[model samples]
Target chain A: MSAAGAGPGSREGHREPRRAVDGALRADTADTADTADTADTADNPGLAARVTTRRGGFTLDVAVEVAHGEVVAVLGPNGSGKSTLLGTLAGLFDPESATVTLADRVLTDTDAGITVPVHRRRVGLLSQQALLFPHLTAHENVAFGPRCAGQGRRAAGAVADRWLAEMGVAELADRRPSELSGGQAQRVAIARALAVEPDLLLLDEPFAALDVDAAPAVRAVLRRVVRDSVVGGQTVLLVTHDVLDAVVLADRLVVLADGEVVEQGPTAEVLARPRSGFAARIAGLDLVTGTACAGGLHTLDGTLVSGAASEPLDHGDPAVAVFAPRSVAVHRERPAGSPRNVVPVRLAAMEPQGEVVRLRAGASGRGPAWGEGLAADVTPAAVAELGVEPGDELWFAVKATEVAVHPSGR
Target chain B: MTRAAPSSPRTRSSRTGSTGHTLPWPVWVPAVVGFGLIAVPVAGLVLRADWPNFLTLITSDAALDALRLSLQTGLTSTALCLLFGTPLALVLARSDLPGLPVWRSIVLLPLVLPPVVGGLTLLFLLGRTGPVGQLLDAWFGVTVPFSTVAVVIAQTFVAMPFLVVSLEGALRTAGDRYEAVAATLGASPMTALRRVTIPVVLPGLVSGAVLAFARALGEFGATVAFAGSLQGTTRTLPLLIYLDSQDDLDSAVALSLLLVVVAVVVIVATRTRDASGVR
Candidate 1:
């Protein structure tokens, strides 16, 4: 295969043009970044790859790039091919049509008729379960990777001790996997993966099995290891169902739904403006797509609303409106206020959502002429003061600026 | 809260008694019969044995030779079984080879085959004029039938399935997660098998070996049929008992008691080994 001379700057600048060839390759940007970053350090800039899969009636095609000191998260729903994508990237499964390039070497290229065996791929994979050798002590588990790489027994043990110390689990070195707690075991597993100094690291729900209380600590430890350049410009691909984790730790989020990239961009951008209902659900936001008009934004079914109008809307121009329930202010009466959009509504119900309370209400007969309910998020203090209850009449005021508008179409 | 009747506690106690009733005589009758069926044979062995002559019988030259040969052949057979069965079990349990189910059946064939028939099959395969036997004779001048080595081979053929089946089940249940983890750590398949797979399944292997050894020690029909009975050569204790029973019932009974003692010793040794292994 001929090597492409496109530099990182060119790749980033022409992302849109390259995306036109295949949307899957566009998703490959995250993996490419990883490869480029590692390549910059090792005199080889092709250490990242993307894999697409067609399996069991679902197609999972994603492009990812990882740079050294970068943590790329593959975020999606259950059965969204997150695990399969990770597996394929790690050479556990061969994609029907995909290209896997690492630095100057092509690990797999269906078009070029190249496929490397998994064991020789030098990719370290950490599954949800730590999967430590039960019979081996923590030190032995960490040493296993180095020993397998052909280090002498004494040398391997020394190296393992160093890693264990770095991981802050040196005291547990002699304890077997069964003896270690979930957090400790994961630390050892991370150490084991890093011991081999793999070019790429694959983590499949590494924190899924951890308790909620233990997850943050483990996540922090993992972030330190993967993000540290001392670990040799490691590129990490983390697959997770937790959006919070992706938002907190990932440099970019690639959302997969039913085997397709429903949304992929910077973590904050995707979270802020999810294009599909699937992405909205993942981002914990309500997404409503409609046509903008001079009077207000019209629902797809032609229901008109007197809400704050964004820029002068051309009739039938596609637009997306996204707002959090907390942004909608609920009122018991139509009080005079500076806010422009205020619609009388009847309280549908109230549900407690963690620290916030969700109030479901419908706009007075003038709202969308179909199944439509507006959700308002408020604090317990606000709910108490407003005496919000099902069947109570209220008014919802939404600021036009709070209602973000994005043009439709790719 | 209600005022209790005088009979309340009595009634409650009686109800509990009824609920806790034991099995009736009908159940015990068959259970007792089954126990007697197993116990009667053991009683007969004790009743017929010549207790006083047991020491003398065991000390006889022929008896001593047979005992020694039985120990040597049984141990040798067990070693051979382990040598070949472990790898076979690993492959059967771990590999995705074609027709594995059929191969599994073939590995287990000896268990269902009559011991004598199994011995005959081995004899046919290794006999002087047998296909592989002729080549072995031509190339190495080794004649297998009616020899001590033949005894070990016959015993191994019958006893190997015990080890392989047990070990295979252990391997399958153990799963490949550890091995996968080892591979990711940079260990090759062989190293993973050695450090992760073998250590994890060591208990199964050890127990399987013990069971195979016990089975080989008690093996009679296959050993006698394939290797033949030759005093001081191929005559194991089982064969000696068969030979003496024809005219010397007392000596035969004494040999029977000696065999029982040896079996008990082996069982105790195995149990001790198993305990240590687990520890």
Candidate 2:
């Protein structure tokens, strides 16, 4: 509903964007400065947008403000309306209600009865398939945008060459799209989207079709090209199902489920403490499902798991109680506590991960969660100190507030 | 369990007629007879042609007039098919306009109609005394039937379905994905249509036009009945051939051979280009 903290989360814990890729280009501060010298980014400062669209029975209501040069990755499951959001912004569909503006230009404001046509919207969209015009060469494919913007063939061809060079696919320019490898075609498609100097960019699962070997190369290109230092940080909305795409390239993360923004924050923040099931699964956390009762959650079979709400839910409404595995504290005995949420469980498995051991526990020594249930990330030191191993009985305890309850993502 | 020898080129050659029998005698018997039924009539025409006098027969004044008329009318009809029939096919492929199937069937009617039947329908619709034709006669004082224009109209009526059907299939195969992508790249609808949609379906359009041209060239009953058979005006090659059949049987056979050659050439040329498909 509002735009707050729209800039990307701090770029930390990421692979160096400037790792010597192909031994030719390095995405470093100098590269950014060099790009700033060549391109005029000040003319297109990123703008905030509020998008609301309803298709058939599905309605997606989301507001996102992409800071100048920030990449916002919209992470969601299939049929969760990620593509719908991008399509609405790109002027493919006139939303039921939306007010989308990039910089001073009003692309779509349904209330004002002003909806720019797609070609005039200045929002370049790339989908999972590169969809290169088969009849066009890679050079001509990249030139298409500039050509459509009224550049002559020679000038547009020059622009295409420049972009192809920047993307490290210049040598393949003359080859038709059918002659291009999947990765090469995707790179050209990306270059084509940027050639027109659009104010906003929308990528719909851009890497989903690429093999694992080709994805990282394109990801590197996005990191180097889409950053504020290089391309003047035009606002980009990347719709992806892969967490790695969010972690590597996105500054902010907006997790959608069933056409609603279930959780959103800095890429690291939401990932650190996912509040929804889809988010939690992608973030690698344990999420317990239940219905909200007077005091806490009532599991499917009426087992009570007490937890505080990150956002309040009406009693009897569906809810999912979620917490990071690291949040659970495993104990050897039933620890005495004052109204703390605690459960007796059998330690199903213990696997060492870095400095910590991943512990899988069930509801109790006898229950459906007997073999695999709650997961807790404890230090390898703790595993040694507590002498915990597979099939060991233990008690798991957590502060009710640490486990966040929210409306079900379904 | 007993097993037959593994299939190799050597073994397959032995199994087939090239070496010995592979299929049963009954299968080849009916199939070859069926093939000969079509082959014999075509062979008869080819064999009956007076090769030495073929050029002289075709170059005769009446034959030349008819040949010229056929070419002119065929070209005009094909042009009309491209101009109007392509848009019709686009509408059929892309739109949900009411009565769509009815319109499609109407376009398809001439394809299945007996040439004489098509000619009769056109004669009724455009005859000087008919309802619509009467209005045109009153307003412009232009009669439609039994004229050069009428010949083209008759040819187009029979040929247009070929063009529209081919184009609709092409448009459907090309789909809207490329056009949608083009729009996102800042292409206006018209630009996308011209630059993306048209080029993508060009092969289909070409084949359709070629087929229409061939159909128009061969049109006889419709052109003769609706447009009349007048030398240098409405009479076309097919009409000339039919009229010649009553007396000059040798010339008619030669002309028939030429028509068969032209049709085969047209089909082969277009099909080969499609098989090669734009690389």
Candidate 3:
């Protein structure tokens, strides 16, 4: 029942905070700087939390910090504890041992036995579904938080109207939840969450239930509100599956995998030079982990991947070579004259990616050691001409200049 | 095999209806017969009523007093059921308390227990020589047996299970998704219950109360056993009807029709509210 034993396996794979590449933002350095700068000051940085909780068979052990008026997007695949992290922060779910400090307020400190109840936490949450109160009109739904906070009826209605207008749903104020469309309902939900002026906002995939046409508009509204609404300097923790949301709305990106933080940095920097396999996959780049060699890296499977060094590395230091799928050329035979890196692979699957067919290739032969291979984006005409099917022995060639070698934290 | 032409919209519609029909033809015969089994008795009750003297028969002082007492006790019992049974239903449906199925079964015992047994159960606890009755008699010299309060207590004993079962089903179906949302919006537990939980299940509450009222109005065996049929004091409409039926058949039938009409009105009112789909 102790916190140390809560997640025995988490610490074993917990690597030291990965060093950022050249021209990249390092979270560790920034955290230290913020700490040093705010040591004696009364100014509080928004939210700093260390959460360790286990639900069912899954264990989530993570530490996260967000500055005031900052939006940190948590990106992860399903079952990666993204929602659990938000729940822990919002006080909807209890954590075994957690220190969640928001806006200089000790919301949760299990050591101190000061776990604030959800209603008193002042952490507004906008879940995937709108989840508006069915019996209330849009205006009343928005007014709910204010009323709960003991506002007068007239004052609450005024606040509701203001928020409704802010979310562009003022005209739908009197309409009940059932009368509003999906987009309108979501807009009302956003207004309801913001009406509280919470110290921290927890958004769990708010745009996920929205249609493509609605998603962009909602995302834009969220971007505007999260950035422009600095009245309370609200710190927002947004959990999302879409990379575009991170790109558009977030100031930083925290990538989670298997209930642990894999990588985190400034959004653009992490997307550009992702260290974890999960981040690389979401960024649509192929990452090959290996040992630093003369030019690039020697993969575990003995494939010498040559690429330009994006970060400094010592001899035999652990490193990774990253390349885009479009940089790879598929050949029937090993016919790479210019490209230095060539590997013999077996076609695993072919998926159409808009204008091109993404041919996924893995290690050839019946070896149990199927190295995470490369994805090659070839034109459909080229695929038809090559007549390639799954299990076909193919040669994947990548130009050395296309790949970027960097020192990996692992 | 000969085939009919796929001709008119009318024929096509009929065939489509046949295609959609999942049950066999024989099922309809038994279903209709089952419907008649319930409907025919009510038809007979209407047909057997002495219409010419209906006003005179139902306007007697005993009849009026019984009717008034039935309404008063039924309403009070229904209110009591709502006040007590709502929290019980909420606990049974929402709380994570262990051994809840046992508690739920115990609460629903009145539904399955015969009315006479239920009356005896209440009597043993509250009768003059019983423990609670003895305490009351010793402390306040207040006798509860064979009183109007006894009638209400017996009615609530047998009728509250309906309210509990109905409201519990509604609470379970409505779920806590809205309640969770309300909590996130800064609503405390009480506020969420008053605003979100109660409002969401208002229709169910109304229907459950109506059902409890109807059952209380029709209570006879429990009332007769626990609170003897004293015309103006302990006797309700059903007890009066039972008493009058022994000798005055005409008044008994008229009272019976009045009870039926009241039950129908209660049921119809609830139906109209449900049909309106008012939150």
Q: Which of the two candidates, 1 or 3, achieves a greater DockQ against the reference?
A: 3
lDDT of 1 by residue, A1-410 (tens): 10121212223422233333344444534333432333343454434555666878787766665544456678887888887877776766778877777655678898888887667778899887888876678898898888888899999999999889878899999986756777888888888888888878888888888778777677766765665555854667778887656644566566777887666665545665455667655666433456767655666767553344433445776554556677788888785867655667788777787898877665457554222366678999998998778988788877765765433321
- CA lDDT for candidate 1: 0.72
Q: Where does model 2 sit among the CAPRI classes?
A: acceptable
Q: Give me the displacement of residue A150 in model 2, in angstroms.
A: 1.3
Best by TM-score: 3
Worst 10 residues of 3 chain A by lDDT: A1-10
TM-scores of the candidates in the order shown: 0.73, 0.73, 0.76
Q: Judging by DockQ, tell me the better candidate of 1 and 2.
A: 2
Ranking by lDDT: 3, 2, 1
The TM-score of candidate 1's chain A against the true chain A comes to: 0.64
| Positional deviation of residue A290's Cα in model 2 after best superposition, in angstroms | 35
**In candidate 3, what are the lDDT values of residues B1-279, reduced to their tens digit?**
011111112433454476654888899999999999989998888899899999999999999999999999999999999999999999999998999999999999999999988888778888999999999999999998899999999999999999999999888887887888888889999999999999888878888898899999999888888888898888999888888899998889899999988998888877877746563
Using Cα atoms, each model's DockQ against the true complex is 0.20, 0.26, 0.22
Write one digit per residue (lDDT tens) for candidate 1, span B1-279: 011111123443553467666898899999999999987887798998888777898899999999999899889988998899999999999899999999999999989999999888878889999888888899999999899988999989999999999899888877777777776666778888888888878878887887888889888988888899999889999899999999998888888888888888887877776645432
Regions of model 2 farther than 4 Å from truth:
A1-47, A285-410, B1-40, B272-279
